[model samples]
Target: MILELNDVLTENESHTLSFMASSGELMCITGGTAASRTRWLLAIQGFSHISHGYVCIDGEPLTERTAQSFRELMAYAPERLTTLGEVTKYEPPTVQDVFSLKANRDIPISNGILGEEMRRTGADVSDGRVQLLAVAVLLDKKILLVDNPPKETSGYLKNLAKQGKVVVVTSDEDEIISAADQVVEI
Candidate 1:
């Protein structure tokens, strides 16, 4: 599916954003504060309402009533939240724990596949950011929303995009931005 945001405006922030990424494309979102980047991703996923303009997929506009349907086609991975769950800086989540979440229970994840996915993506396995990214990749959704990804996974993310998945990553890292098919500084 093709993701499009045309002059979109948020409720709390007046900053307007416009972007698009078709299937097999990798779009990078850079700049702005962490909250702003998260807002953009949520807005695209139909959680954060757009005060103006539109967020559309395959030419169909995303609205409040259809937000859940839109989200069904997407998956998001946040780098770090205000409160780290059972974390003490470097206390990354275990693969088993991540997949144990209610939302992930339906996905068929195996031990071999789990280890391979993490290893293939070069996920640190000890860093929260990398762990989150690994989970996002495993979700295998049509649209992937990631925030603050490690630079080492650029190639994997690129490959994911090439596989016809719309990969939208939010980062300020030069490596990630440089590898994107398109870059937009929010």
Candidate 2:
């Protein structure tokens, strides 16, 4: 799997960034402010439009015809746990609850995998973010985009890279940047 951004302008119109990554690599996008880091991740995930350039996956340019399929090939985890919705609204759902959703039913779920993810995130099975990350891992998308990942989860992200997942994380933290296999500073 490969992800490439060439001369891509972010939604803010203040920065143009470019980079490429292949499977089994951990890439960190860092620079400026927290917002810039988020924009870079969004742009790479094809959530934010590129004003002057293109994004490609496996040599295919991201066009309207292929956008949906392209999105299916990647999974994104945003910065804030709140963005994922209420973790305390009702009885805490288990990792199984996440995999049972329509969007994830097709992916096979295993207790071992769920246990590992729980351990990695250091989150209880009831945590919303933990459930979300569990789903992200089970999806097995070619690319994984995470924004402002928790410091404790950096090792888990790296392990994902080692497993041949193209992991892209955005942050301003020096420790996170240093832990990645490649760093792109915007």
The digit string of per-residue lDDT tens for model 2 on 12-45 reads: 7676888889999999988778777877776665
Distance from true position, residue 16, model 1, in Å? 0.5
- Candidate 1 ranges with C-alpha deviation above 4 Å: 81-103
Q: Write the per-residue lDDT of candidate 1 for residues 1-186, one digit (tens) a residue.
A: 899999999867768999989999989999998778878887887767688999999998998777878877887777764343665532223455455556689887676776777787775867767667766778888999887788888888899999999999988988889989999997
Pairs in clash, predicted candidate 2:
none
All candidates' TM-scores?
0.86, 0.79
Q: Top model by lDDT, which number?
A: 1
As a TM-score, model 1 comes out at 0.86
